[model samples]
Target: MSENDETNLPVDAFEPNRERVKIDAGAFVQQGNTVYRIAQVLDFESIIGIAVETGRSTPLAVAELRPVATDKEPAAAPDLTEIADPDWREAERRFAAIQPLLGRYMVGRIEVAGRAKEIGVDTATLYRWLQRYRATESVVALIPKKRGWRTGQGRIPTFAEGVIDEVIRDFYLTAQRPSAQKAVIEVLRRCQQHGIDAPSPSTIRARLKAIPERERLRGRGYKEKAKNKFLPAAGNFPNADYPLAVVQIDHTPADIILVDDIHRKPIGRPWITLAIDVYSRMVVGYYLSFDAPSETSVAMCVAQAILPKEEWLLLHKVEAQWPVWGIPRMIHVDNGSDFRSDNFKQSCLAYGINLEFRPVKQPRYGGHIERALGSLLKEIHDLPGTTFSSIKDKEGYDPEKHATMTKTEFEEWLVALICKVYHERRHSTIGMSPLRKWEIGIFGNGEVQGVGLPQRPVDRLTVLLDFLPSFRRTIQTFGVTIEGMTYYAEALRPWINAEDKEAPGKKREFVFRRDPRDISAVWFRDPSLNQYFKIPFANQSLPAMSVWEYDQAKEKLRREGAKALNDVQILQAVTELRGKVEEATERTKKARRQAQRRREHEKNISPAAPILPVRSTPPTPSIASLGLLDIDTEDFGDIA
Candidate 1:
């Protein structure tokens, strides 16, 4: 390997003191990538509890997990020497001898991630070796072979014969078709053409029942038992009657590759994000992105799903796939790192939408997204288009000249087809097309009224005033100016003055109450009484503020901008209004005094001028004279 390659092998991340292992090889598990509870060195027999995977071709993506310590104790490592027996023969025999030792050293009772042949030497031989050759005084006796599943009797091509084999392939590919029965009929016709005596079309009807192979393995996954079957559930979703109460989101690497349009060379594989309604099984939002699965893509999927076509058009006029569906009350996703990121959580928080996370690596909780990915992977893999390279073909194949193709275009074509086929096509379980189910409002509650979605305006601007570049010198005045626009908030003003202006650094700004009527996610601006506060921008702006522009500025750069204006400008705006409150308050007091005097005068009693309250006085101090030192006279005589 090149030195560069060696450098990139996670050498910087590895710590010598800990067992910081990076597994180099493993089969793709159908969820987030890393297999949990993996043992560094595994020894096992017959790969017991070996989960049967259906689609090895369309592998599921697992999250890239970095185990973080939240006050978590370091993982106790298994002592390797405990299992390596010097006296034992055959690896299986050695394991049998050290069963008790392995049990004590290993954290868990069951060991996962083992090679099948390493331990399983035909169950009988393994057992014989375990007892006679490898058993130690302290080791527990090996349990002899339990009845095997007996599944290895036949091979794949022979075992999955008849409609069962045909069904597995056809069911997944054409599950979204309008008439799945017709699809099965087509398969039967193909079989007949192959010289097999095919059954009549009517006779094929009853045989169709045997096509559901997946149904047999239905309840094989983990499920939680009900704590109280009769009790009403808490945290019940909004609108029990709505069809779109829950939505699940997931991202999978699209089969399509992005290519440079100018030079049709593959740039990279893009991602396809899917948002599906849990109730109607409707594809609410579908987005194709060249970037990694980020909160931006996730939020876009949600916005595209929730906002109506007109609203989307008002915001993004040119896009053709703008969604016209309703908002999902609950957004469910696997506990992937991206989904748990602050960017994603902030979006959820801003929208007041509930974000639900499935347990780590649990695809079954987010089964809708998983199933959608399954369909997408197959569809894209099967899609055909002319492949191209850079605009200038390096390989010498040129069309008019050296013409090339991009995978992005192929992906776009696939996306369109899949959306039409998978989304518009009928679902097997729902017994209706996604559009049909969506329109009729058939969801978790069995109601006719569809889900009511939340409306998030695109115009809301989020900014932190404390960090604003123009924040200093701008103080609480009778009024304040932001971006050259002035606003009148009566409650705010008067925190700016000569004292504030001459003071070093930033002076306090005005305190403004938040208008309850405002829908934008904004808080009232209160000038810091030596404390911090943030204000909202005007709900809408002709030119939208790029959220990053302010955040990206360096402290020195922002302070330079802040230095442009001083507290003097704020004093000018608000000093005139300062006397208004005090003067008004005094005038009211004087008027009350005058009225009371006039009432006394009318009663034929000359009221003495009401004395203003007498000021408090200080007590007088006693006085005395003091003496002085006499050394200066003698020094004057010596000088003379």
Candidate 2:
């Protein structure tokens, strides 16, 4: 075999094909200069391939392979931020029409006909919308025809349309509350002045009626009426008939205190962000962190919920089957600032997930998730470091003095409880174990057909990138700078100092996604290719650090009267601060916690050692043999 045939070749050899690629038999994988055709998949971990040019046989590890973009695949999802308002509204309307059909086992002709009639569209048109939405799994796919006018579109001239809009905004939408006739008269006069044929009075009325009810009321100076009419009414939870039909996510501080890895002393409670499947009452995903609840926590928890958990479980050395994974049809959440952020909303829309906010002041609307979190916290109350929920409950117990478990240990214990205990034990409301409920919903019982598992995303990293918070920065000659750190890669060469096409004189702002856990690299999405490239720090000598640690270091320098700082000075400060944290780890609770956080970041970025692929659906255990007779269940009263 030639020296180039070795898999140890540098990444530079495959520079031309360095875009996102999928793993599959017959797919061409380019590593350095060698282009190999995947001949066969021996297992999930390895593949046998033949070099295209040399016709030489090669065995490749799946982990070492990188995906390359191909023209045969569908074009990347549209940038929702740039979508026109009218198009966005149309897409939402179409999505609403076909939402019931999504995630169904099968759509029968009768169901399609009924839905079509309800939405006032023909069955054929409804099917087309369903096909498009399912094919891309994106709301953008349902956008109305953009190139030409479709049915019900105005056939009037552009000038006439503009005149109509001006009249509606200026005349119709006013405190005077002018009549439709008056608005039509104003539109006619404007069209005549512009030397264009005026649209009929009926067309003008139709356009006025097209305005949203809330917007119309507000524009007509009926702000109070709009608010009164639009306030969400408290009601029972929406029906979630199947698994992943609806998942509720929320954040709560853990009831137990955690000790640091080094000193085993009590640190403050960590926040837990959890996602629960409403139908089965199964815990889908969770994130444990010292940081307060933010968009980052939501993103992390959602990503974990949607991705396979086998690898993550193995990473923590937890032996259990957590079979829940897939995109939910709808995510029900409270009206928190983090949940309502544009970044989070856009990410959900891109993935075809409907985001429904709970009505204000309605505790019962979120009862399912709240109860699930309560149960988990109740379990935590039994642990040695438990805060015991209330002051009365903890009157004699000293939680801080009794703190024993480290964060990692607590994570493992929580996973065990969720998988082995809660999921396996029978529930009061469902009258069966959550695992069994999920199984029957996904795989189906004798009467009802199951919808089966959701289509696993081909690019797991891209799925995560979509959920991560994004920043827009102009690429400088040296590269893009974010939060005092500079990142650069050869992939950014063509975009250096690029001018914005929309605004010729201004620099272009490119989209970059970063994981707050690790600031060593940021993922940049190329506008032309629509692929993410990992850009590492320009100065490679700087050690890996979390954004929190970075901020702490910067704050320390500010307190020390350092007026100005560069990337190098800030990193030096971080290094010195880390040393002090290590030195004080045994003496102070805060220092020990900080050291633990640093270790977590390091562990997160470290490469995971390979493990055997866990079975997706393990054998269903018998409920009778699980000894549920002594288990107590709480009744939340018909959550579904």
TM-score of each: 0.34, 0.73
Superposed by TM-score, candidate 1 places the C-alpha of residue 477 at a distance from the truth, in angstroms, of 18
Where in model 2 is the C-alpha error above 4 Å?
A: 1-71, 103-127, 143-236, 446-449, 605-640
Q: What are the per-residue Cα lDDT tens digits for candidate 1 across 52-142?
A: 2321222221111111112222222111111222211112233432333231213222332131133322343333433322211111122
Q: TM-score of model 2 relative to the true fold?
A: 0.73
Candidate 2, residue 248: Cα displacement in angstroms equals: 1.0
Model 2: number of backbone collisions: 5
Query: Cα deviation in Å at residue 351, candidate 2?
Result: 1.2
lDDT of 2 by residue, 1-640 (tens): 1233344331111111112233456766555445567787564356788876579988986545543322233444435555556666567667767877874657998999987766556688778788777655667677655467776543566567668778877889999999878888998888888789998776676566556677789989998998667543342245587889889999999999999876788777999999999889989888888878988889888988876676777767778777776789889999999999888987787677878898788687788899999999999998998998899999988999999999889988988898889999998988999998898876678975665545444334555567777888899989999987899999899999999777899998787777887888887777677555779999998888888988888898899898877777887899899899889887888888788878866665211111221111111122323232222111010000
lDDT of 1 at 441: 57
Q: How accurate is candidate 1 locally (lDDT)?
A: 0.36
- lDDT of all predictions: 0.36, 0.72
